[model samples]
Target: MKSDSTVLPDVFRICFEHYNTAKNLPTGKIKNPNEILREFDFEIKKNPADAAELFKDMQLYLKLTPNTLTPNFQNQLFSGLNQYALAGDWLTSVTNTTMATFEVSPMGTLVEKKLIEHMNRLVGWENGDGTMATGGSNANMISLLVARNKMFPEIKKEGQLNKRLIIFVSEDAHYSFEKAANILGIGLDQVKKIKTNPNGEMEPSHLEEMARVSLSEGEYPFFVAATAGTTVLGSFDPIDRIHEISKKFNLWLHVDGAWGGSVLLSSRHRHHLKGIENVDSMTWDTHKMIGTGLMSSFFLTKHNGILRSSHNHGGEDYIFHESEIAEWDSGPSSLQCGRRSDALKVWLTWRSLGDLGIEIQIDNLFTMAIKAKEMILEYKELELMYEPSSLNICFRYRSVSDVNTLNKKIRHRLLEEGNFFINIATRKKETFFRLIIVHPDLNETHLYKLFSDIIRLGNKIKEETEFCMVKT
Candidate 1:
């Protein structure tokens, strides 16, 4: 690795410009790809391509990047970046080592193990094991894979064996659960969806009913993926009740806490995930809740060393060399041969904040959600969709007619206006907005502006549509 001056400087300036332009979102000008990139492919063909010229081209790319940092950038679950985590990311890139090998990513592997140990303790697991994954979905998938393997080890070698193996998840569970089921060769149909209540929490009775049906229908119901925090509604399925059913049915209980798992740090609110300690496995995404850099997700299991039994693959020689007490290489426990040092970012973020810092942050976010709910309820024009179980407040503005269509148009107008961005969701065949309070910078003013802007837009849209309807 020759210290390439041009490439290094180019990448740095590019990143700087990216951080700058990400917030300057376009109001109406969005050129099509045909006119924007203009070419099908691009590469670093030559050396010293003039820093000034390179910087200009990079700025254009930066302008297109999503401004995940802004208070108005509420398009997804994770809305901001942690400064500490971002610094760790820079160090990670500088080290540039694959996480699979101990000799290369020794520190990275140890950091992840430490993080897992800390997280397991947070979950109240006395003896547990875990591994960092590419994303929450991948982590969730691995959870299913490991649970399946642990429940039916013979299937690993014998392969499904036409037993019609099935897994269960709430209808409100993330789509990743189904995707994981598909990848494990269980087929999409084998992923049964349990019904949920109006608030979006999975009904425990529904889970038991589904399990009975599956068993009677001659299908093996071996797993139940519960959601600690569903993406759209932020609902928590009754984990304690679900755990009881799982224990009674001999099911491998896995909780998808990628979105809401951070509550483990909030001692005041950790009870929201009651009995999570009893679950067989769980997926937690620090990146989503803690604002760690991307891909900081972990799949943890209470069964000691089950990941090795589940995901251990590839070479039986050379790499898995002899060591006194096991070398602790991450490759054997992962789905990928070469994982990144994603753990360091998460580790640094957690270490910097400590459990107390995280608790405060989590508490703050929850308070913000409560504030948002109160503000929404105060507005006669605003309708509280479902009582927020966690940090996501699902609601939309109330209007005279075409409530769903009006809400959708107001959302579209709000996005096009570019002052703010709140995501719209459809639940039970009704349209509404889901305001996420995950970003640390969001405060009362932010919530007030969001509600005020929404009402303003709703009124404008209602007037326009009503006049149009009258004319028609």
Candidate 2:
């Protein structure tokens, strides 16, 4: 726990400098293993290295890593860390505490509870229960666990019964639902994929029919997951229509809003999740939309006390003391015993922005998404794969032949050039770049630059191919 006084200051100086200059740096440069080895001395030695030498290594590592802070970096669901969120993260690290008990994490526990309460109310739950999860995937699993335990309470002690338990989700929903099924011992076969419309929203009629078939086959249909924002197409399922069917079948309704849940803050875009409050549970990640840093995910439930009852193990007598505040412990509700204080960054971001500031941030991103679409339509070379429902805008460069191949090549070349970092996804056998406009500073200029880069690289590839064919 001891170090040279100058070492700490030197490390902070490098980090602060990088944060200040990241926007000006390259988004990322894809490097092969040999090239990376040449660039960085990544070997571990038995002896401690000089502090100055280690600091230099840190700088090189940061330089080589993708600069996600830049507006051009849109490869993933999240971008741009809020300054206050970073400050809160530093504070949490310095404190070095677990969130298992209120006695150990008094402020941490209160912050998590306050955030959960605020988010629950927004989801239309007046008196609901919730907990911070490790990530969106973990939150989705928690929802499934609670739903299963609630329907078959005896399974807690007796284990799963002979009856096959079934869960339903849209064909385009996040893959975490299926993963959760496997983890919960609900066989992959029991995770039914409901049909989605061309826009990627779940078809309520198809879900109802599938539920009926499950019942006819004597299967236990207990859960239905609707997506607020699917990964590839950024589409929102019709929650109100889906709710009607869930009620008819007596299924536990869960909304997976990990990507687009922040739209709840937007007065204009909240309608996409109009009936979210009616759902039994929800998964929302503030980090994805609000720049609250990583792992700011919450699993909220309208059913109070369900999570604690479903997960409580009645741990050792030493840990679970019979104190008045023992009920405030979060360990029972969470999947992990020693959970990190994930809520501090979220609270700091929320407090800095307030509700209205978050609304403006989301509203602006939606506006930019529409603008990106408009620009794509103006050019014949660029094809808009699907109308944007959120910030994800999928499109590809047009080629008379090998359109998919051409788009893939363009993406690869873009990464190699290290000018921008975006991602591509395939839907219905077509591949296109899934441009994310989540970064707050992202604007029309960055979008144009992206399109220009793709077109430029795509045309170059086509010319080279034509020349090869002519020579042959």
- For all candidates in order, the CA lDDT equals 0.83, 0.91
Candidate 2, after superposition: displacement of residue 134 in Å? 1.4
Best by TM-score: 2
Clashes of each: 0, 0
| Shift of residue 181 alpha carbon in model 1, Å | 1.4
lDDT of 1 by residue, 1-472 (tens): 3445777777786676655554444322234567556732346665756665565666666555446777666667887777779888999988999877787788998888888988898898978999888889998899888888888899988898878988889898999988887778989998888999988999999899989988899988899999999999999989999999999999999999999999998888989899998898899988877899787888998998888878787765866666752558778888887777988888888889888998898899888888989988899999998988898888988876779998888877776676677788888898899888888878887778778989998888878877998999
- TM-score for candidate 1: 0.93
Highest lDDT: which candidate?
2
> Clash number for model 1?
0
Candidate 2 has what TM-score?
0.98
lDDT of 2 at 469: 100
Off by over 4 Å in 1: 1-50
Q: Which lDDT tens digits does candidate 2 get at residues 197-313?
A: 999999999999999999999999999999999999899999999999999999999999999899999989999998998899999999989999997999999999899999999
